[model samples]
Target: MIWYSHVNEDSLPEIVCSTGYNSVIAVAGSGERLIALLDNANLEQLFVVDTNMSAIELLKLKLVALSELDVEDYLRFIGAEEMSSRERMRCFIKLQNKLESSTIIYWSKNHHFIKKGILYIGQYEQFLSKARPLLKWFLGPSFMKVFNNDYNSFSKFRWKIVKSVFSKKVSYLLLGNKDPAFIGKGVDTSLITNGFQELIDKKEFHKSFMAHLVFLGSLKQMDIEFLPASQNRKILKKIQAKLKNREIKIQFINNDALSFLEDNTSTTFNFNVFLSMSDILSFHKTDYVIKCIKALKVSNKCKCAFVFRSYLRNHIDTDIIKKITALGYKIKDVSNMESTKMYKVHLVEKL
Candidate 1:
């Protein structure tokens, strides 16, 4: 199952600015972030790293779609434009020729998702769709209006009721802590309630596609326009031009990230690198991941920027930041600038 349908981090600016002429290595989460990076950054190569075969296949399909289809067809085909299932299937059939044999086989079995639109195919997304009605009831009628204008206030009684439905006990009951379909996919038990609370408390909820998905279960027209990967016209044009000129190469590696890094450290030391470690550190032992990162072979001739995210609270301890700093790097917390407001983003650059 696709764990994410789009990017939750708002680090595109960091990724793009720091990635000029350098090689990038990013976790291929949802493939949307990778698409955006490809469009905006002048990278010589992009190493798409992920252990999940399904995620790799999804990115492969996306690459072919971006290369083969025009802007409009590409949007509609990916479910960003609300096309009919038959139309999307037809688009997929047209693009299937450019796909690898494994991708073709994967899509052949999962054509049902194509019919519905690939945007919301994630198991977490489906769960959100099923929960939308209940969420609407709890959010009351004014919540949807936030997308149109501003966040409307809820009465204390309404707030209490909403909180009850999303209480820790109830949430754990509904979304088990161990299920790969839920928490394992990074859908924290408090995500929905916290998202709603954030919307109620913050005025910028309208700017976030993630907030729309958490609250509305589907993308509104505004949300569609705000999607950096699919909606940015200039970026799309840049991507098409790069693809046509064969100026950039995308490599997909299916392996544990640490192992891949260890194996490739010899070759990577020659090039300036920007690594996007998308929330993987949130799941693994912090010391283990940090140890792997510290083991990377780099030299004074090249620079490296390593960005990682933590979704459930600020997962990075003070000692961890010190550890990263002790490795001859400077750290910046870009969480406030993050559009999702759901992750604590730490951008560490070797000086």
Candidate 2:
């Protein structure tokens, strides 16, 4: 059980606290942020939810792994503003070992599906080779930098949108076009609708729910690419070790947005906050919005909130807006366009 994922120390807690609800139903990205927030805030409980079973297993692995590192290492590895070279290498080795092991295990169990993806891409071999220039233009040096452990540079390359497209192809080749939560038909779309603006206004259900997207990951490509990089292997392991320590029970669900909002009995889960990263606008189903409203009714917590933002226009569902306002929830508009590039974060809570 290893969620071979890394989280930016700074952003994790902010999103966890965004809803202003002390308790929450959250999407666990690598469960890295969820775990870190738990440790830092010492919040009694967090329901880590996702559709990806691999994500669930991986988060469990990371939670177990983090305990191995001391608090200073956790701060340096997971919380530091920057890492010195010696510290970086020290962390690198720790992260790498777990990645190598997990990658091997992943391929081992899912080999056939993985191989199928490899064959599909062989048809587009030439396209892929030419793709590098375009990819390099966007993903930038960080895509290559992390793999090479170019510690000299500080900024990360773009979210690796360019690289991610290719990586999906690679993942498709081996994993058969779907991992735990991500798939076609809008299963877990981190990209499909990211920058789409006009489309947001078109959703029929928006009148009833204040819909928005979360764009959950920071440097989207880093977890997939860098964690598996030869140079990054060690750092990946250290990151894994840090996660292992937390002893959190994290689960990956791999369902759609609506399915995500429900409990086993079909009630909207009773939690304080719901977090989404950019998939709000991508939802083609109305049940998802209904679930949110239902969840609000069930919440014992005074303030229930859903936080959303996006890489495109932060689509606010006009109907949902009216409904929440009627329910006495105040919405705060926060912008991070410079940092997140078209990103907007909203904080909503019941007065």
Per-residue lDDT tens digits of candidate 2, residues 1-351?
222244312232244454344455566554544553443233324566665556555454344335555544543443222345456445535655555465446535743322222111222222333443555565455534433334334243344343245334253334333323233343323333242222233321111111111121123233333221111344445444434554334344556434555445445445555454323433333234435554445445444665554322225566656666776677665543112223445556657
TM per candidate comes to 0.89, 0.48
Off by over 4 Å in 2: 1-13, 16-22, 69-257, 264-280, 283-290, 297-301, 312-314, 317-319
Q: State the lDDT of candidate 1 residue by residue for 63-138, as single tens digits.
A: 7887888877777887777799998889899988889999999999998988877777876666567666787877
Query: Cα deviation in Å at residue 10, candidate 2?
Result: 7.8
Worst 10 residues of 2 by lDDT: 204-213
Give the alpha-carbon lDDT of every model.
0.71, 0.41
